[model samples]
Target chain A: MRWIWFDRFVEFESGKRAVAVKNVTLAEDHLHDHFPGYPIMPHSLMIEGMAQTAGILVGEARGFSEKVILAKVKRAEFFTLVRPGDTIRYQATVDGEVTASGASTTGRIFVGEEPVGEVDLVFSHIDKNMSGLEFPEENFVFTGEFQALLKTYRQQGGAKVAL
Target chain B: MPMSKDEIFDKVRATLVDALSVDDDDVRADATVMGDLGAESIDFLDIVFRLEKTFGIKIPQEELMPRDILQNPDYVVDKKLNAAGLAALKKAMPHADLTNFEKSPEIDRLAEVFTVGAIVKFIEAKLASK
Candidate 1:
């Protein structure tokens, strides 16, 4: 999957929680089609941003051995709309141990301390061979770019994992 | 010179409520941390951290959860907790109330025994030993 939602990790504490930022800009392709004129950020994309933040946190806690996927969103509520030039910050906290099969987390979105959204997300893990087809490691989306981005974020004083 | 059971329970209850973000009334003696009180695995670590800070005690991870012992093939037969494993757990965690746990325990449900009272007892025993 493309790591499109979050831009960088602001704070990460492994096995506990994480904070990431997503910058919304008018130059993005999604903003044009989401609305012909108004151009408000899509809530679904916001949720995906939160999920990606939580997913990385969960994966790091498990030493990146398991393939984590979003299973369900138990709860999601948005109090405000996001627009271009507004940076959305997501804070995700793991609710439990990230087992090989499943895990759960809670995420909240903010714009400079103003709470805009909150979500309770459940995730499922599948083995690399679960689909009976083996793809080379290089074919995966979490490759050089992702690692470089994570490294940059880590230099910002974020923990190695999620929190 | 350890805390009274009531005192221990009060502290444990507070810790659970704070860590799990559950209501104070929900953290009862018989309330299971995962089921009734809505605590997940990550919350256990938070709870342990809080307990360590509150009581000034250090609880090793292996002793606190014993994941290795629980998952060992020799200690688990056909996904059920073997007698030897159960006995070892009983000895290791004398503070927890496992009286209601099944004789042939399901591996996943083992964490259910970590109720609010169980944590209180664990802290009580740890403080007394120190």
Candidate 2:
């Protein structure tokens, strides 16, 4: 199973905000073993979904030049449990200027039109923040798989989606 | 109207509480950000972001923590800051009180300089300059 969380970007505004959706289904092996009889979408994965949604937004804001890594989960609070057949909508907005060192993002998670949770995250441009550390030359964070998702979004009429 | 030191301290305390998930009482002025409040390396970034938002200020990476000095061969010698390094650090962070740090300039103890009070002073200076 691939590590990609959300299905696709539904709405994207460069340097500002992006929205993505994910459909929960029992076909996912983790849901089956999570409770056996009572299957609810794991909160941890939901946070991951939010991270992917916000993380991509942050990475794209900088033209994917920096290896944007999720540095911290500032806040994650869920109001309700998500179940199979529910479509999770992740709306992420950049909280402030995307500095060379790092950026902070505020996110809202919704199942259909009703709000289910919120996940606020912080991402570091590792090259700028990790002063003494060294990472690979290539952009490992935004691999082909992640970029393909953005390409798919652009092909699906997200004309404003920048490369 | 300019905010008083108490007001700035209150706001900084709140920011530290949110960023570090520590109790309100734990955010005393003398508390070291990493040692007493338990802030990891990444948490410093988070705190900087929060401080920027809370105070409506732009905090450059070097201004808050001059990691470059630690890595500079001329500034650091045998894991300790030389006289030149101490002067450079002082120039970099006028907001921080380096009296105690000056006595023994070990690189390891650099984190001790960033106490909650130091942050309040930093913000006070930034706001005053504006």
Candidate 3:
């Protein structure tokens, strides 16, 4: 699984919340095609980044017993366009109790100290048996790449998942 | 000192409302936490954590829901909870409403009995036990 949106987790607090960062660079293929003269991060990918942040939080809340998928975007607001070299910080907070059907969360996207976007999202939790795929041994909280990034983050003084 | 039933109910109600985002009126004592208030399985952890914080109590994971009971070969048969499993569950969750447990004593169905009142009673009993 390629986690193209977010690169690393800065802080992960088990069931409560998470903070991640994505650094936009000129090498990204999407940026080149998004605009010819003025290449910028597409707003859609920004929303995806926020959803991934919140989805991971919800999945961790359940101890990866359930597959958490982004079901809906309750609300989303954007403040500015993201350009290469800008670092997008995603902070996701789980709202209410994470249920089996899904969880609700609000994510704030920031660049430096300025707020760029915010998203309210709903995530659905599906059990592995219900999803109908033969059970394969895998990390439930994140993809293998993301897990490795988390380990690096932990080594560099990042917060551990409280669980 | 142990809290009064009403005190425990009030705290449990507030915790459910905050954790599940349900209305104050919806968190009645007899209201089913998962069925009526729309709490999902993951919500239980948040509810348990909030209850512990609000009352300053330690609720062990097994005691709270006991999903591990499904692993017992004697307790489970045909991928369902057998009679002995139900009895063990009754002993484990005396504070829960297991009155209709025999109707459908499947291991997965165990979460249905975790009503708000049951949680309050469980907390009360736990506090009293100490």
Candidate 4:
């Protein structure tokens, strides 16, 4: 099963910088009736972009050996409206860090140079044994553009989709 | 095995021919997709999706339509594009990297790639060669 969180990680790296791309398109079903005449990338998805980017960081910190979730939003700020045909660029820096249990990341979304959003994100990497849980990947699978999009994830040096 | 430009271009073209319904003669090496083949905005995006599926390559929107790729084909064959076409698709797509990607002010800038087939072929060639 494909995971939507992995879908957003077009690029993920450790210390320097990481980028995630969201191609806002009209075909996304969620965009179906958002005022008909025009479609927009919802603010929530932008926040997800940050969360996904942070998840990558968490995955890296944890050696990607465990499942990770944003777990909490902490703080989120939307700066601009992300529209179809525009690529939302998400970048994150390690604002502060602790052990693998948790870390705080300062992230932002930009449509080109224009800053579209900012997120102060927090994530938890849980051990399945410790959490006593088994979550199906299909349950978290996103549909439409997000699902098709999940097939494409890029690393900065130019990589292939692992899935 | 390392891939060659012609070989990559050929594979990309085959997929485009199927998806965009264009003849081989129409997709020239230097022809602009939006300007030459007459692809609409949706078609261009569809081509992108298909490219992702076919070659296992994800083209970042920004890299797909980079100015130099059309005006100059050599730019598409970047080392990373050759090695990580899918990741390039995901990472290099225009909106994702504001700093490194070529910025376009034209809202209709996307509409300019005339043929979806060509754009797919172009990106595919670049991505496969690495």
Q: Pick the candidate with the highest DockQ.
A: 2
* Highest lDDT against the true fold, candidate: 2
The docking quality of candidate 4, as DockQ, is 0.01
lDDT tens readout by residue for model 4, B1-130: 6555576567667755654567887766655555676554444444555556566655554465543332232333432233233334334343232222234322234344333344544554556554
Off by over 4 Å in 4: A1-11, A128-163, B1-130
After superposition, candidate 2 runs with Cα above 4 Å error: A156-163
What is each predicted model's overall lDDT from 0 to 1? 0.76, 0.90, 0.77, 0.55
lDDT of 2 by residue, A1-163 (tens): 2887888777878888999889999999989988899899999999999998888888888888889999999999999999999999999999887888879999999987898999999999999988778899988999877677666767875554433
Please list all clashing residue pairs in model 1, or write none if there are none. A12-A163, A13-A162, A13-A163, A17-A162, A17-A163, A96-B41, A96-B42
* Candidate 4 CAPRI level: incorrect
lDDT rank order: 2, 3, 1, 4
Which docking band does candidate 1 fall into? incorrect
Which residue pairs collide, candidate 2?
none
Docking class of 3: incorrect
| Clash number for each model | 7, 0, 2, 22
Q: How high is the lDDT of residue B121 in model 4? A: 48
Residues B1-130 of candidate 3 have per-residue lDDT tens digits of: 6589999889999888877778999988788888899987556655665676688777776786765676788899976888888888888878898877679787667767878889988999988886
Q: Give the runs in model 1 whose Cα sits over 4 Å from its true position.
A: A8-21, A27-38, A42-80, A89-145, A148-163, B1-4, B18-23, B38-60, B102-112, B127-130
